[model samples]
Target chain A: MTTNHNQIPITYLRPAKGLATLNLKDLWDYRELIYFLTWRDLKVRYKQTVLGFSWVILQPVINMVVFTVLFGQLLKVPTDGIPYPIFSFAALLPWLYFAGSLTRSSTTLVGSANLISKVFFPRMAIPIAGVLSGIVDFVVSLIVLVGMMLFYKIIPTWNLLMLPIFLFLAMLTALGFGLWLSALNVRFRDINHLVPFIIEIWKYATPVIYGATLIPERFRFLLGLNPMTGVVEGFRWAILGSKYVENFDPGPLFIVSITITLVILISGVIFFRNTERTFADII
Target chain B: MTDIAIHVDKLSKKYKLGAMYERQDTLRDFLTSMVRSPFQKRPVSDNQILWALKDISFDIERGSVIGIVGRNGAGKSTLLKVLSRVTDPTSGIGEIRGRVGSLLEVGTGFHPELTGRENIYLNGAILGMKRTEIEKKFDEIVDFSEVAKFIDTPVKRYSSGMYLRLAFAVAAHLEPDILVVDEVLAVGDAEFQRKCLGKMSDVAEQGRTVLFVSHNMSAILRLTTETLVMEKGRIVKRAPSNEAVDFYLSSGFVETGERIWDVDEIPENAAPFSPKALRIINEQGLVVNTIRSTEEMTIEFEYQLDASVTGLRVGFYLMSARGEFIFTTFDTDEPQMYDRFSVREPGLYYSRCKIPADTFNEGRFVVGINASTYRIRRYFQDERAITFNIDPAGAPGMQWPEQRLGPTRPRLNWEIEKK
Candidate 1:
């Protein structure tokens, strides 16, 4: 498999100006590094903990319990007709994944300062791997969601096949914000302190504990502005089926959220690419 | 044209010094700076910009190993970093006609929580090896590290020596067509260092184009045929390794007779003790870099202590130019002196030692100073702080025209009995 020296392709490096071209080919070439880094992130996260992967299951389950007790029991937040527990759990699955991935990926560049400064690879791989590694946790919690559906006597429908599209949308939203924040974190560590606050406020804005139908009819588009709103709403529609919910159609809101997510994702990639060249020096 | 491994055209890298240290990297500071910038009349000046590599242009042919030698801040590391793609230049174009692998440091991506086996794969991939390549070389890497039993154990549990060995082993096995290395041989024990050097020579023998940066003159001379000497962010000399090393050693230190430590040069942790200067003096009492071997000379160290220190002993280590240690002597070597200066008060102090006549050979020697409260804390140390030459004139061996060997020349009294 050895190639001739003359056959090797030449790579030219120059000063980057304005927005750098998305070097997807270079990123593709370093796919193995991304995989290894993702594997490392997954391995190192739960190490030395007695609970290990159980924390993955416990985190969302506990949040669901707290929301159920506070909103379902005390505040009497309406869930249309579906059971409150499953209603919140379905939405919690995607919400927790987005929140978790966003937090991890935002600080990823600063966290891997040694790797960024000492090695040469597609700099985007660091944050992308950060987002990808959260999939393991999402999958683990997904099984718990399935078990909860079974416990609540909810059966699957054809809409369940559409679940991946919404999950991918969640991934895109997390990665978009992650790319922006991670690059910013390299220079101004203020992003590190700002990420948790963003996530906390972001959770309340998205329809995690409450249903989309609870919003006033005229102002629903404002809710759609939050990308995670469509993801959490779509998860409930796909899993719980629209037949169970009262008066919610995710089609229009999904369109708005998808467009906004694309804008953020594309712009975030551009910003990340432009700023990544200086990471080794500044970091 | 096809045989050229690397080529560059007026490559330059400009770094904003203000961004690195002066500008605060917080949102509040950023906002305040924006507001205050409009009110301030001063514009960005030349002092804020550092051209780490200024209009550097060179080419390297395939199957050649080139060495880079320079003093600290001469931009040697910056050049390697830019070539390795670890950082980008301000305005320039550099082309490489082959896959490149750079080891700016050993184990760049090693996670302490990961096992040695896992880290081998991670570090290997980080150094630009594919998974299949790493798998193929897995056994070899493990064997080279000599830590087979601990392969499954986390690296955090491994001793520092084992960690370094494992890290270097993985880096040494990388087989890219162009390899860039920077000061990686400055770590590990002597035996491991020899192994690393051997592995490097093996890589060099394989006909891959290599760029090596090192402060070890001996290693550079042994591994590379050609060398580039850099000064103040420019290539001042390019020649064979022998000539390059000689030029670097002779002119690298701007001040040869005496070395003064600047306030910024000393680290913050060395507070309560600050070194002022280190000097070599001949019998005539003038600071000099070249001394006659037969004359008695003195080595003096000036320092200050902000706070009283107990058990503080200041000393200097005498070493050969080849980095071999001749001896280490402390000021409080005598029993009476140790008892009297057991607790040195806060004040300026000078520690001086006189070398008897006929001590050194006709060659260059280096002096390094150390200040410490034995076993408690090490205040400061500079291993190759200053170097000087000893001339062989007027020595016992002056009668012979041929050169003498070794780092020392001791005069021994001899008599012939008429038996």
Candidate 2:
């Protein structure tokens, strides 16, 4: 066995300093762990509940109903001539996925304190798993959106291909903020209290309940800075098609949102990597 | 170079004391500190920094089994944590030449909500085993745990013994070029413990380097050839297991004749009954670490009470070097004395017991002190508090050149009635 020592890989451990590389190869090597952990999160999510998977669909549908009543009926909020139920329900799918992934990812590090402190793996897998586990919920809720689309007699178009792209964008945005908040949550438990509040305020800022046209033309760029603005608007555009909504273009808004998301994500990975060494000690 | 499995060079780790309290772990406290920093004149003190491991260097060859022995807080766990990469060292470097599997704890990532089968995979992955590897060894692991029937049941529903066995079984199957283990044997029953030991010996037989840390002297002596004795934050002695265990058992305390309790060493719950010191006095009335087997010796315990304690008994347990209990004696063992001192007053007191002449054989003896109110509360206990050696030259066995077997050699009258 000693004769084949050259074939064995060596790992040198030293203190991390300054900015560390993202080490994506390490993440690639542990891809199976990411899968197992994501599987675990999905399996354990609704195990004992009576409603089980129904809660996934009910959450968005119930929110869509309340928004339709408040904005569509009494307030008479415009949906660009698209039916209020289908319009808002389309946006709600991505928004709820983003919110759910964000909340779960931010708490992932603290929640898996045992794994972090006891074992060595790519720490990034934890939050990534957190973001990935929400996809089942997103896909399940998308079925309800399809049912609503059928009810509204909306025909599928080439724009339907863009749904996955926008959903991926939503996942990236959640992962970006999730990495940042989860790493911070280890040292400052205040992040635990702060995440839900952020989600609550972030929902009203995005165009989930109403159309993006509600934002005045001049301040639309400000809306685009919220990252999810583009994702939600893009989801509506992709599913409802350009003909359903009036003069709604996701071009400039996507540029702004994608740029912000990439910046957050790249920097979030850097910050998380730098602080990863101290997590076991502090957490 | 190929033979060296691990090379640790001047590695050290420093931890800030009261880290959670001193560092702002909350946003409110952090922001407040940030706002107040400009006006604050004093910097943080250096005394709060503790070097858990200091400038330690060692090299272990492949296929060698090494043991680490130390008292609690002596950096045994810290060293293992650093080598296993659970935490980073403050300075220097450690190079490993092969895949490392560390068992700092058993079933580290086991989830109560997951079935035992699910946990095996999760825990195996967490311990650095591949999924296919786990799948291949799945049947062997389940058989080892003896929980095949309950493999699908959530681990929370399993009995505690079954839980521990399954956890250890998964850990036992971890095949890595180098293995790092802590006090995992401290759990499980005696029979299960023997099985774990057997499995570990098998791992050792496969020519893998093993770093084992345990307080069980017998386990260390049996499994390891070379042992490292640690004190404070550095390796003070590295020798064969016999010499290392002897040195550790004899000089591990603050001093040989007496042990003075430090304020930090005493837990807050000890409360009203605070121990001051424990001492061993000889016939000449001098504190000593060695005495003749024929000479009577006194074991004294001094403590102070802030409030009166009812039914308080102060006693000491005498054990041989192998941790076998010889006997336990209390200051109030006599019924008359128990009645008189049933209620210990709020003041300092000394409780002493004498071992009669010809009581002990020629070997090292350990004394452990305990103070408790019967069936109510245990004030304090310091097991292995102090150790002393006995010389059999002056005892009844001096005429025979052969050593006596057993912990004690008593002088008893024998009559030749058979003839």
Candidate 3:
């Protein structure tokens, strides 16, 4: 936008001599492409399906209902003070957003092989677009969480203002792992099946179905190692308020999770940039 | 400002070939190969490393259109890929000034699920156009594609021709400082192909640099100022369009008696049928270019059918210098051979036939080849493939000969007794 010239010059391309070259300027120039790709993805997501955008709301609601019947009713998992459905839905919302985006982002490179081999663009745009497209589903599913809260007639405290921070943290956690999975998937497609398995296992470890205290106090920190663990708990605490979640504080877990998330996210980006040059050749 | 729009220097790309490492594309293949690698020993020479491009360099002045002509696997696509940055070079570097739009294939990212209107915007963005730019040209693109009536429909339902029309239309409207186009014209029907060629020529006339790669020599002759001929991973000659086309066509046919097919030149579709070599042997059993008109000659066609092919037939077409068809003969034309080999099993086979003395009339003759099954499929056919010079000065009728006009000069015996 700031350029005086009509056309941008495409400079030399060669084998990297030292560190991986990240064409931040090209990415910036093509930022609109990312938006369009994300927009295209959002539109195509719901096309031709009878359910359409309802699937966005339906996915979390269906899983939450299943969890409530199994964990909240059949076994009667202790839920501190708040109702089980609201508690479960709050956690499930962020968990699904994180899981869905991660799964989609991991395969984005291989999925867009046609684009990668033919046109010149910032390769990072593809997975980033994939991760960004999940925002629509995230916002849509958030409405269901609010409806559940009204159904339970629960009034939130001032801690509700902190929900945005938890949402940002969940996005960070999702994008961090999404970057890693998507790049790895380009080479070792075994990562494709592995991503779903990890997400499935990660859901249980993150306390999405049951409350956070379900983990024994000694091993609770171990759960925080999975970044989504702190995110899910942070969501529950922010939505249900501090008093509702007993026997645990989400503050320390959030710190640990955020640190791990940033570490993974940075390394994921580095690895992706490193392996991107070989994608067209190998894929 | 420098006038050079593109400069590639000492560029090279090496590819390792082997079944084991030939693009272990799938993770399953990688895992299985990993599991099997330590057990079986692989010879060091088993994997042949080929340099797709070798220290090649070229430059294009601004506002000039250049064509690259090459045999398949001669590194034309590799050079384009390197220029497009789809894959990194092994060693050298290439500098491209100004905005470079590359169409490696038509419709790089057109999702079939998206409607035509949405796909245009998506494809424009994929080619690095901004929203405002695409919006400015949106109507022009729609009109040029001539699919405005069906613009709202998903492209998957459109006939393939319509799909290509929309795809090529988007590419044509992409206004870049430099354009790189490959064999995208091969996809569209003839009329659409002409439309694409016209659009490319229009772009060229706008004083933008263009790099075109195609097998259509007529298109090259009409559009390009200069052409680069590549052979064996190197640019052998760069000249004006006519000279380069002449060099490409005539250089490989100088050796008349035998023609050897390189492993890389054989097409993949010619799968079960691979032609290895073809030669003509004189009466003395030596392969030679010139043959006496009265001497018997043998035409030998050597090829391999790796897999059993039912109804496999090998044939040759003999033609005159001006492409006049003299005769077409097939190996299976013999009545007795009908049941002798119904299905060709996996093996190397040679089809050779002897021509009696004085079978050819004079000058030079050409031999074309056809390898296929009757009414089933045609694997490979090359018309006017190779030519050989024939000498008739020493024939039986040489004393009274001026010029004979026919495919064969048969020397028939006549009694001089009064009848």
Candidate 4:
């Protein structure tokens, strides 16, 4: 029945000629939804918990202790002349955020299946909010890192000013991989089960615990294949004022990470857009 | 008058029944055929494909409330799903010029852990409403839902009735360009059903497009301007609501033996003996489509008694298309030949039961047969005997020539006293 007089063209549902691009206007319209969802996630995460925000400090501190023992005292790994605890904690800050954001954002679809299948929204808001809300924990842990550095009396060099850029890069990486895994997780729940194991393996592969300087100069080019290798070492070098290890160039790694992240983010949007129609049917 | 709000031209949705989950098997079959593998061939089951919506097209003008009525598994839900973009059509296209908001299910986007207040905002967001827009309607929605007292509490603690109430309240206030609802009103209580019907009428009054799917023919007649009858995914008939209901009730019943079923073209060798076929026969034993409620009608059943049975009871069941059982009677309770089937033969047996006129209410009633072996110590049952329908022929003061009430009309005794 022709009922409503005001006819608005819902262009999002219109069939497109090529890849379905993420409608930026729609995202802008749903900005408040993103804020509310992010706020909701933050509140629910700590609302009833005993430790509260202490969990944030506890996560990075515990990982710092474990890594210092496992790679520093246990393996007798070098830390580029900096204290072992400080070295690992510096890298742990961003690596922890990246790992946490990737895992959380990757499962955003499966976690919000009810919302996605029932209502029409910019689906990307969920994963983007997931990755963004993680910044709270990141900032909390960074405070602990700064306090620890003060206790050691080690003043950061001028290079520390670039820390925000490095943190943004880390978010980009997480957003990229988050989109891919989140879409994949909706179809194959195997991705959820595999994320933690992959994150564990990834930590050791990157220069989070052991310094990038420890990887022999000859093998540095091949190791830079992992984009986070440069991110972790850059975070350390920028904060600790350590000279770049032989053949450890941040330029190529940044380029590779940005390119890979862009590809994943774009493709993830396409995959999610195509499969979203069937969500109510199969979810 | 034909300001088409929806122009569905040659619109069809073909669902490959099982192919969605069997794509891998099809790929395997294609690869094996190319390689000429020597592996043992095992035929695949559940490979049969059927179209849910064959090439069917119609136009709906603005400011009309259309009711979609159909039997179970008739693809009414599929049609809504396609229109709402919850699922894609395998073929064909439908063009519509309006913003669509569908209440395919109540509370479609509610989060149980979130409070009622939070969920209102969340649901509004999901429905494509802006925060400012929701804020403007916030009080009205809460007031209409009657859940203002517990608006701050998490929805998980709310009763199902309250949840549906709030959900429907949100959708009702949306005022979208087009609203599509599917059997959601059935979730609430009777009083709420009336309120929801009133709300739908208001929506239609505002000249917005509304598509409603319901089994309650009474509600359809009261509110809808037009109706479409769906069967096996095809729109069998589209007309004014009353005419569609008439055609639907008439075509639903099939005769077999002393009982009836609500199906046309009964499958052969379908049921195992005992009331195998039924037909509505007159005093002359001639089958007729229409029957007078006051006339003598015989229900004939072609059945088989495999074993030497004692206390054999046969019953006739009358039901509505919605499967509401109207009434029932058994053969063993009848006079004269009550115990006559003692030495029944192994082959087909014919049992004719008679019904008196004006005893049944006026409405569509499906006929069903039930039989059981009645031994003193134990009993074996043959329950799903058969089924059919009874049409109304004689009732005065009722809207004559059809297009008035729901599927049925029953005559009950009423008395008045004057002092």
Candidate 5:
């Protein structure tokens, strides 16, 4: 059967608005590649290691201990009257996944330099696989966090059912910023050296170790300006069943953060797609 | 209507060299520049930006095979990349109707740590093939590449030949409407190259479009129905295969910078001690012209005398461009030797060995010049010294149909016996 090129519906095959000519349908057709790449990243990262799957648990577990000592004992930071270890571990769950995924995904373009220079695929797949692969580690880390809660007799409230929503929001945030930095890293070599420093400063901006309650009541809304502040506090609220402090609700704040993350994710993708055409020549 | 699989409309690519767009003035710089703009107006130098390709256009029918012939850096690969969607053109547009499989480099997209089986699927995905489609053709591709036993092994364990064999096998098996190949035939041995050429010919015969870029003129002439000759990023000639190749070869004049052969660098297989540099020169020692059969030529050799030697034999042999040895002559074999050679004059040995007229035939012949320590173990044999084209005054009487009888137009005395 012959198909008329003119008569075909444009929306069925055209690039979503704002992109010059990125074929989202073609990316969908190659979705299996995305799955395989994500699987390969997960397999290769932990293969033949001494700890094997334990390292996934060990990462956030160790971070939670160090943070509990530093932020709880030495600094005497209040944890909303709960034990400090549980409070820090809950927030560290989503933050660890976001941080780990961000570090790997920001270097995705550089680490896959061989692949990008030689092969032809949707270049988006590299960073996408990187960020998605962290889900496996995030899940493994979540089990340990749940075990810690049981050890402390801290029951997860019904708000735990909303955990997946918060988890997805955190992943989208990592992916949005990861894609922007990876593309920029290819042109400006200095980005490779700046990644660790950026992650260090960003952690302070987000309440990974201390509770979000430490922010003064007046400035609490401004603290949610960093997208991960909502994710960290959202994880604690979902698991610890906590309330927004000082009538400064996280509902509008979380909505604004999600909106901001979505904008970054979409625009980051368009910017990456435009710059991808020049990657092979300049890369 | 006959299907037109590919279309081009005013396609062009421009490249800028040595020009960087400066960052906009920072806040500090903006304050500083506000006081300076009225006093100082600086003109910028126009950095030499070159358009490697300009206003070039062509269309390929659904099943037509086209050959793109050009020298190094003539923008052939850039054109293929643009067509394959590896890069975008600076201006203009190209349209394609079906999936495009491009082999820009053999084994380029293969990952080293992945097994051959995994890479077969990964590379297929990279080239836009579905996993199920690659699975369907998996056994066929493995058998064709002859790497079936090693399919489970990582590609880093495979030899270079094995890697290229499997990579080309995957590219060849990809069932796409158009196949874009860029000089990939040079990856394999001569026999395998012939097989690949035959496979591509069969693919074209099966009503698929092929865009081939190669330096091998004979293969280009044999495989393509239509050919385009490019020089300095412009299509200088477009015609049938034979006429295009003939025009391209003749376009290289003996004088000026229009020579076809790249004589600047030594060839990959050139001689060790023949010359740091050598070229055909006239009696006055200006690099005058290519040798025509009617002219008596001087075979000039410029070499460095590394050590003292009593009998050094310097010579040259004629060969086809394909490295087939035709004939040889040596200075010692002619009983001409400079005895008691010591460090009399070190550095840059210049010897003008004269070639007598009427001793050669017309066609392309490579100069295999060599220098040996009297009778050393053939180790000092320099296989390629230089390659020169030989053209004669008049056309020798010969029938066109017997072209492959031999490479040379030699005059041999013949006799017939009747029983």
Candidate 6:
């Protein structure tokens, strides 16, 4: 059945001859969906609970207290003359956001199996929303961090404005890793058990509870290899200022962090694009 | 735009039959396969692949309501899936010239925990509607769904009928250039189904391309301009709606004792099950569709399982030719029989049951096969599978020319008493 009706645009579906299809334009078209899903996740997150949104602040606050007790009192880990609570809270702000985003984003595809199979949208949107939703929790916890910094009387300087930029880096890091994990999780379920363990091990490698000075100067350069190192130090510099940054070079660490994050994120996008086509069949 | 709204060029999809569970794309799977390579003898081709769509090609015009009809597993869903881009084709191309809206399932993104109001936006976004577009259609969608009162309530609290109504309402208002609907109207009560049919007809009349796949023959006859019959992954025939339904229904009924299913007659949805033959046997064990009513006869259904499926109970329902009430029985209906074949292996199996003498009236009876795992699940059921006539030559009723009312014609002992 054929007729000459010159109205609708032609869309061709065929075997795409390529290693991957980024389809960034399609992603751009469906950008509103990403916003709504992220909003939905944030709205539903704290519903019908006694503590409700307090859980957001309570998680990092409680973690900061535990680290102060163990690392500060028991192990006596140096904080480079900065108060341990503020130091830990400052670093924990970005660290918890990274961890939370990583956990949620990695499972976003698996969680929405019905949507993936039944609807057509950029598959990347689901995981991106997972990372975006955590920003709300991060913003809430940052307020609590500000309150704690006031208690210690260590005022933030010009570096305070760069907190969101560092937070964006953390988001990119989570998304970079999450893109790989979410796409991989669609086929291999082993990623589910592997993520929590990765977060646990990853937290200590960064200077969340302790200061960067705890690691020897000889091995200090190696610490920058961990992407979170720059994020944590970036957060510290932004909130606590360089006086507490302990002569650490923010320039080189920032460059290393941005470079590595970009590489991982771009590669993650390519990998996700490669495997997304078969998600419905496997899922 | 092209003259053809949609052009399908040699569209095909190949799926590995039994290895679906073992389908692995991870490094662990690769490592295991490499580790066992030296010890293994079976080649990769040993994993049999079923071509769900095999070089099928067609062209659909703009603003035409086309219906796809076939027995289950005739690759109808696969065709829709390929067109909707749910899964990519193995080797083919389909040029769809329009903003296509496919309703593969109602409530594609409805979260049970979310309120109906929230779900409208969520489901709309998933359906490719922008925020501004949904905001504009918000009132229209709410009014159409008839859930305006409970739009604030969580959808999990709504009755399933209400949920489906809301879902269908959102989908109805899509107004895409081309609409692909697959059995979505089968939900809800008769009245709602009628409303959906009316709405679908309105959609077709509005000069939008539509591809509808349904088993409801009457609906197909009502709304579709033309129909395509799919059998075993290929379009076997295409004609106007009425004639196509006639050919589709009549092709299943044969005038002989043994009905041998041809390749095209076997449905595509009958995956893992390829029916071989269905036979009617007399007391002496000879196949016969027409048998003496006073003698016992057995009906046997033969099929082969391409993959091993668990808890499969293959049987049939014996009904009258005019589609009256009848008994439904499965192979695993008996206690011991259920245990014996609880886990079915990949092989040929025959389910045969004997019916007592004088069980049917002097007319034709239909045998509808049911293949499922009891109430837990149902795989396939062909209600009008085959028909056979009973010749009551020497029965008690043969002396008189009276027509019986019900399905059974029995010779019960009764004596006339002086009142």
Candidate 5: what is its chain A TM-score?
0.90
Q: Count steric clashes of candidate 2.
A: 0
Model 1: per-residue lDDT, tens digit, B345-404? Answer: 999999999999899999898887889987567798766678999999988878889888
List lDDT for all candidates, in order.
0.87, 0.86, 0.81, 0.71, 0.71, 0.83
How many clashes in each candidate? 0, 0, 1, 32, 0, 6
Error of 2 at B130 (Å): 0.9
TM value for model 3: 0.80
- lDDT per residue, candidate 2, B296-407, as tens digits? 9999888999999989999998888866668888888999999999888899999988888899989888897889876457788665678888978778858788878999
lDDT tens per residue, model 6, B1-419: 44567899999987765435444566587568878885775465733677889998999987899999876568888888888877788888889888888875777788887899998898888888888888899999898889999999989889878998899988888878888998886446777888888888889899889999986666788889899998879998899988887777666456678877765456545778878888999989988778888999999999999999888988887877544446878888888988888788999988889888988888877787778764444566666677788898877778787877777888888999999
RMSD to true structure for each model, in Å:
4.2, 5.6, 7.1, 10.1, 8.9, 5.7
Task: Supply DockQ values for each candidate.
Answer: 0.66, 0.55, 0.53, 0.18, 0.16, 0.60
Positional deviation of residue A11's Cα in model 3 after best superposition, in angstroms: 0.6
Comparison by DockQ, 1 against 3, better one: 1
Q: What clash pairs does model 5 have?
A: none
Question: For residues A1-283, what per-residue lDDT tens digits would candidate 3 score against the true structure?
Answer: 2434446566786875567856577678889999998998899889999999899998988888898899889989888866788878888888878877887788877889777866767788888887789888988788887777788877787888887777777777777777777777777778877988898887777787777687789888898888888888888888887667666888888889889989988887787788888777666
lDDT of 3 by residue, B1-419 (tens): 54788898998887655422444566777567778895775454723777889988988988899999876667888888888777888998889888888865766799989999999999988887888989999999998898999999999888877888898888888898889998786456678988888999999999899999976667788889899998767999999988997787666575669987877667556888988888989999999888888788888999998899988788898877544567889988887775677888999999987878778888877788888887557787655456787888777678885776677878888889986
TM-score, chain B, each candidate: 0.82, 0.75, 0.66, 0.63, 0.67, 0.69
DockQ category of candidate 6: medium
Query: Which parts of model 4 have CA positions greater than 4 angstroms off?
Result: A1-7, A10-29, A156-158, A242-249, A274-283, B19-47, B252-362, B366-419
Q: How close to the true structure is residue B412 of candidate 1, measured as C-alpha lDDT?
A: 88
Mark the regions of model 6 whose C-alpha exceeds 4 Å error after superposition: A1-7, B23-27, B34-43, B252-419
Q: How close is chain A of candidate 4 to the true chain A, as a TM-score? A: 0.89
lDDT of 4 by residue, B143-214 (tens): 989999999998988988898889988888887778888887655677788788888899999988999987
